[model samples]
Target: MKKETQIGYRVSAICGAVALAFAGLHAMPAQAHGKNDVKHVLLISFDGLHEQDVARCIGSNACPNLALLAKSGVTYTNAHTPHLSDSFPGLAALLTGGSPKSAGLFYDVSYDRTLYAPLDSTCTGAQGWNVVFDETTGIDAKGGGPLINLDGGGAFNPDAIPYAKVGGVCTPVYPHNYIKTNTVFEVVKEHIRGSRTAWADKHAWGYDWVNGPSGKGVDDLARTEINSIDPKTGTYYLDTYTHTEVFDNIHVQALINEIDGLDSTGKTSAAVPTVFGTNFQTLSVAQKSPVADNGGYLDADFTPGPQVAAAITYLDGALGRVVSELKQRNLYSSTLIIVTAKHGQSPTDHTKLVKNGDTLTKLLEASNYLDSSGNFGQNNTTTGNLNDGSGLSGTGFVQTDDVGLIWLRDQSQKDAVVKTLKANLGCTAPGICADGPQAYILHGERLEHWFGDPANGRTPDIIVQPNPGVIYTSSKSKDEEHGGNAPDDSHLGLVVSFPGLHHGGRTDDRYVYTTQVAPTILSALDLDPDLLHSVQVEGTRTLPGLGIEHEHSQDRD
Candidate 1:
């Protein structure tokens, strides 16, 4: 959908929130000294989870742990991710309370017109540059495969970082610097005295952004790396359904360790995080793997396939472990457990699947639009294998999954590119394309309304939201993908659970965005939500129906 119409969703979300603002006024938890007793906030992002997934699992009693949590929580049946549901933007929405337009992050690997390449330390002829800091940005890749270091080779190599102009001087832009907004971690640490923070995720290298712009948001950020090869078995942790489960376990163990007042490794003593969590990858992998071994669903309804069912069972067990630990420490009543997702998988119906081998790029290259690399994706072989970052290497930088993100070799050629792209909406050769619905292209004012103008760096010149089930991929390794405006891609499951919740299991259908999580976390800790940089700029609202009195956040519409 064009951002023009896509933004209407946010307008509606505000209306829903306002209508339900006082619906749960009587359900406020027993306050302590005019504030909530919540000392910790555990945010679990089961990446690629849907609101229907929670409903189906809860109705069928498949996820008892989640159901129990829901029993004492407010289930926001209409929660959603931002327009571009890539993992980076998805997480940014949660941590910054800012949409991409304000946050200045579109995708994990995007392009910018103002920055220079990493190697251009001297800022020679500084101009546009491609930005890529994904798993490829690590330093310990073994023969172009799994990484060797569990910490993703420690900090990022200088050669892979981008150079941005700070105070009119070229400086290396680390992952944390890439974000234009402050994070919840920063607010918690700076405003709340003696508060420590930690986080765990699949990668250890690129996620330094979790530390926020100051570079000290998270104190004990975990160093666990899921992309690393197991030294003993030589098996890649993400190669199979079973292997992915092992990766999720590592993150879960880290969270459990944090709950026990220890570091992620469980060897060092550290303060429990004031605001900390991890993103689960098992379900995401299962949804992408082959339908045979890691099937997503058995029917168009939310019925889980064998593999998906197994993944959900494992996630619920992991959640149970976390809850058990909280109860053991008598922290359950004072901790707010938020279960949500970064984004949701697309095309739940396998019959509607569409796989056209990178049609958008094919169309662009056919018309002679080329970046430094001859094609799309990160192909900078000059930087060591681990430094394979996505950037201006390709023609105008094109990253396509369910949606197409085009940065264009020449911004002046945008009209011509749109003419060519619109001409070839039909499925081209190579893979299946079940004709189901039409796609929309966003450019000019329609695109700029949601993201900023393309004249500035970072925002893509054009965006393509393909017909519901279409994914631009020639590979046969996976069935579903995210990173788009598809229905399933943006519609997410969100829950705010605590033992003190009075109106437990209350299903709140008010539309909400995950960006609201940042302010809600601060409010739960009895801190001013205004302390968040983006919260002040975006006027981000807290989750309604949670009657916890928030400081200076009610002004948000």
Candidate 2:
């Protein structure tokens, strides 16, 4: 038998329900309910974390905390993020239980149909200007203008904006504007009753939107700012914090003060949430481990590897601290801590991939596809021309970290562009764009598998995938990146540990994709996993061993 299967069998037997505990590590399962039966679910996400890196942490003993958590939780051997693993969309999935296919969040800068749905020039209104949803934008473009005080201006400023200055607007959709589906957090509040929650994130776009409001509403749905100050040593250090949470050590004094205020009988007490979590940037520092951090990459230039490791380690430590505090507060065993990530980064060796040399860029450049509008592909005229002279139709191109979605003005011209891309990239028959075994093509519905929306205004006509090592970053930034189908980009780590989790430490090699994360999280929470209207037609299914049969997606190949 294969080594992996053997290991799986052994783990399955060891962690079987009602089975004898291995070395008395965990207690036998029993009924859990009510306030006493409640579980404080903590979903801690380490952004840009890679599955391989987590595995490496286990191998190298770099992340002992995570390793111990893994022992108590079920680890998915096959977990992946979307082809375009950006912070906004990734967090959207975790909170809403849907994919970009449904959410209409293809990228940070996405096209909206409602405001711009009817492409006729006569549809004039502020909504038309609110084409792309910005996380900072709290407006509902479909509703004509900003929704709440927070919409146009407030403590939480989520508003619709344009991708560029010239043509169509790229509105920024926040949790309120972005998510149309029911969220697990909402479900949790619905059934559980009397569960106070709190959350903190450094990323403007990152948050558990379903369970918490975007800004100012939840007891503590604000950002946290962290500084790696050695309070014990009275020394300054590098640390991360969100916008509203504990700042440098001195700022945290206020939090301490607030807690103290809760005790003074006559003193007014700031509301303290029963369930609260805040993110830090210490791990992000690790993922973007600079030369000062003693990892790869030179000064000013950062690699994703060390930074990812650091972020994981930082969160592990923070989680440990939180867990310890909870235990001290006598809420340890009852709390369900779910440590996860918004999404993982697509590991890129920019230095090598660029040097290997491919002609696709040059071909596109020669055809004036790169900068159609002379505004350097910013807006307006850029969206109208550039391909087969089919007027302004072929101007749609969504550039990602390692792929470019080219929408042709005319469907008939697609084959010609495909041929040109193939010839330039040197892709073989089966491959799409062949550039020294580096580039591949994804067309039609197959592309839809990776990207939820693949046709009409939702889909890109041609997806340009770079080689594994290649990362198609914009000219401005030269650091870490994501948004590709490469194994390094799509692959991520998934650890599920909760009251009803049937298995632990057992690896499931059955193929899994990023799209499944939504349904899986929903199922684990015992919520319905309906693929939202914003998502593609298909929905993710519960795994076989999880005590429920679920719909499994067919193999892409």
Give the top-scoring candidate (TM-score): 1
State the lDDT of candidate 2 residue by residue for 1-557, as single tens digits: 11111011122333454345432643332222321322455566666666666676776777777776676566666776655566556666665556666555556554332332223233343222213333333322222332222113233322222222124544433444444454444444444345444455542232424443333334444432122233444432333222112232222232233223231121445443434344444443443333334432322223334544445455566556655555566655555555556665443343443322224444554555544332322244323422111122223444555556564434456667777676665433223344656467777677767555444355566778776655443232233455666665566776655443344555455556555555544333333445232323555554333333222221100
Q: For each candidate, what is the lDDT?
A: 0.77, 0.45
Residue 485 lDDT, candidate 2, scale 0-100: 60
Give the root-mean-square deviation of each candidate in angstroms. 6.0, 10.1
Candidate 1: 10-residue stretch with minimal lDDT: 1-10
**Cα lDDT of model 1 by residue, 290-382, tens digit:** 676657776678677887888888899999999999899788878889999999998788887878688776666667765423543344454
Candidate 2 has its poorest 10 consecutive residues by lDDT at 1-10
